[model samples]
Target: MQAPEFLAAHAAEAERAIAQVLDDRASVVPERLLEAMRYSLMAGGKRVRPALVRECYRACGGVDDARVLPAMMAIEAIHTYSLIHDDLPCMDDDDVRRGSPTCHRRFDEATAVLAADALQALAFELLASADIEAELRCELIRRLALAAGCQGMVGGQMMDMQAEDGSGIDLMQVERIHLHKTGALLCWCCEAGALLAGAGSDQLDACSRYGKAVGLLFQIADDILDATASSETLGKSAGKDAAQHKATYVSVLGLVPARELAAEMLELAIAAGSTLGEGGQPLNTLAQYIMGRDR
Candidate 1:
């Protein structure tokens, strides 16, 4: 399949895993909270992270997407939860996400907060409860927790908040924030996929390197888009970063340079993916998409 077609197919598979995981727990979850979770979790987007998980597994010679289905769901769930909290009034304060009202905007603030919290816990629960070998389960849980914890995404967020005034920051500092805030979870997705697939150290290392490049690429793309794209086109507020004077690639390096950096990262990601040979096409394509995406 071609790039768009391949990504679309994998996105569908990710959504299917998300649906099955949520549907199975509907009986036990509270109705309103479930609806809140559904609102964001089901909101259509690229499903890039879960797709990476599945694609990395395949690239590592694992034929079964189901083998990593739970991991896919868990990764996506954690991502969705992060979005919910990120768009809170105290954070990005965004009204829209993926072209619709954000979780807090769609539901009450408390509901959004609680739902996000629940989704975070649910991700670990899925990992811990999966039918995989105990060691694999433990490893997934341990890595995911670190990726999502204070030293990773949360720490990056704190740095982001501190940097919003736009003074006393450099490109390196901005990249550090991007690495912690965005790169960690993405790295986990790629590594976790290979780990679950029983890939050797070399394959795992290849995927991990690809993830690191893609993670930076993802944030750089966002920075580029924020400076150039319309809110309508982006499915969320645009130019808000500049308005807030926040330090981003676009803010620190300018649009042209940011785009150039993103290209470099994409090329690096593709090179890393090439190490996986033919099965790595999906990852290479996804990396290209990260650079080319307008929204």
Candidate 2:
């Protein structure tokens, strides 16, 4: 199958798995809270992180089922939570997301905040409850916590906010912010899958390298899109980086250089994926997809 088609198929599977988890059918919860959570969690977006988990696991000779499905759902939940908070008034203050009202816009600010919080907690719970071996589950939980905590995504968000206040940040500083903010979780997705499959260090390192390159490439693509795409095309606010005075690859390295850097990163990611041989075709194709993606 075509690589983009393969990725879309996996993304569809993740979307279904995520929808089931957010529907509150598996566990009991307040109806209103569930509705609020479902409002954003069900919002359509490319399930890139979860797809990574699936593909990486598959590349490592792991099967997808009860053992890995819940873990995939957990990552999706965490990603949704991050998106919710990111669109909050204090954050990016975006009204639209995924071509619809953001969670805070659909519900209220307080509800949005609580929903994000709930999803964050649920992520760890889902990881902990995965049908994997206890030791493997523990590792997943640990790595996830670190990826989402202050040392990673949260810290990057903080750094971004700080840079937005007219604070002059250099190119390397911008890279640092993105590496932590976006790269951390992406890296964790690949690493977690390899770990779940008990992949040896060599394979693990390849996935890790692929993740790093893919993560940076993804961010650069986002920056390019934000600079060039319409809000309608993006399904969300565009030019947010410039409006918020945030540092980005485009802002630091200029458009041409940014695109060049992304191309380089894509090649690096594809090379790393090729190390996995045939099992890495999905990864290799997805890297191309990310590079050529419009949204």
Q: In lDDT terms, which candidate is top? A: 1
lDDT of 2 at 10: 66
- State which candidate has the highest TM-score: 1
- lDDT of the candidates, in the order given: 0.90, 0.86
| Candidate 2 lDDT over residue span 176-257, tens digit each | 9989999999999999888887899999999999999999999999999999999987898899888877888999899999
Q: What's the TM-score of every candidate structure?
A: 0.96, 0.95
The residue pairs found clashing in candidate 1 are none
lDDT by residue for model 1 (144-231), tens: 9999999999999999999997577999999999899999999999999899889999999999999999999999999988899998
Worst 10 residues of 2 by lDDT: 1-10
- Residue 162 error, candidate 2, Å: 0.4
